[model samples]
Target: MSTKQENIKQLIEEYMKVNQMGPGDRLPSETALSQSFRVSRTTLRGAIRQLESEGKLLVKHGSGTFATCPLPSIPSSLDRLYSIGDMIRSAGLREDEQLESIQRISVCPPDIAEQMRFSENEPMIALERTRTANGEAVAHSINWMPEKLAGPILEGDSFSGSLFQSLEFKAGVRIVGAYSELTVPNYDDAHMTRLLKDPQATVLLLKQLHYDEMNRQVLYSLDYVRSDIFRFWVRRTR
Candidate 1:
């Protein structure tokens, strides 16, 4: 979170604490709080807007802001197993996955097998998802599922949630580990023009192979996450 947002959040928490506000308690007027804190109304409003979005506060017309119900606890994000939802949730943004295609068809390109480690021309479920953060399209993903085991799942909108999550909860395939390789590629002019806002922004690509608990190969994925929206680092301790 940005420092400004963090400071505003802290102020709200303190207000809630000192006032002993409980659920359904009406918060002070925005003007009152902004004046009391000697901050611009815009900053105070930004804090409240985020709080409202996160379910901490609710605004009323001609009335006053009040606390609504709190959200149920959700598990913290972790490594080893990951999902699109986990990525967005941990980043303090909402997640939505819109399917582009899901169908079992003959491989148009035989080289997919070399990437997926399957025999040439084997059937596979090709699924594409346009990932959104804060409801804005941020990434594009493609994954291949082995055909025979995938059954009906390969043909339709089975993407009610994360593919990895659904694989475990529905298909009994537990994802134990995976490896990823990153590359900076020449931007796809057509795709980047629409997505990156800046034509010169580069694209970050990750090609990954996922394995099951039984150590069997299950999936191969290609993720195109925009470089600007993501910042990554590695830490090595001496």
Candidate 2:
């Protein structure tokens, strides 16, 4: 995001705070906002679109933009990549800080090595945790990343909360996007069944290849989500 865009976003947020705008409240017209901010219509629209993508605003056809209702469950913001911890906190849910496992891989698995674009013998770090919401296990996630990107944090106790945040704060790397894949896992799978502990449970499997600002692959993750606890949907815009 550019500085001007950040200013416009902050300005709009302040406007809402000052006016005490709630859900369904209409925002100022684009023309009025453009003129008031002294920015081009294109720039103003870009900032508004960013807010919309974040689920902060809604745009109606033939009607003006309005404040959207609070998110019920985490919606897929395909345009922007975010950390699992951030999503949990955004929905007012509790996060379990207990890590199931974290270890270093001296010999990278072939498939994972290919995904991270690492040499066959190159090392990596794996982190696994079971996330909870309201004291119930909601998901189990396993993440792998290049040692160069996560070595220190993975080896130390500082690896808590959002790994994305940890990477940025510890290593100065910013994630910008991800290649995501969603699927329904088979109930008979031993590993998944053991993690979920219910044969009849419905599960949503998410696999993502995370990329940094320069489009370099930084991390890969697999998450097994309990569908009964958390529902996910994609937002499509023409």
Q: Say which candidate scores most in lDDT.
A: 2
Candidate 1, residues 70-160, lDDT tens digits: the string is: 4333332223345546756777777787887787766624666776677866777878788877666667788888777566344355655
TM-score, candidate 1, is: 0.61
- Pairs that clash in candidate 1: none
Model 2 TM-score on a 0 to 1 scale: 0.64
Clashing pairs in 2: none
lDDT string for model 2 (62-168, tens) is 89989865434654464556666666777787766558777788899999988879887978888888777656566788898878888756647335677887788
Model 2 residue runs over 4 Å out of place are 1-73, 155-158, 194-198
- After aligning candidate 1 to the native by TM-score, how far in Å is the CA of 184 from where it should be? 1.8
lDDT against true structure, model 1? 0.69
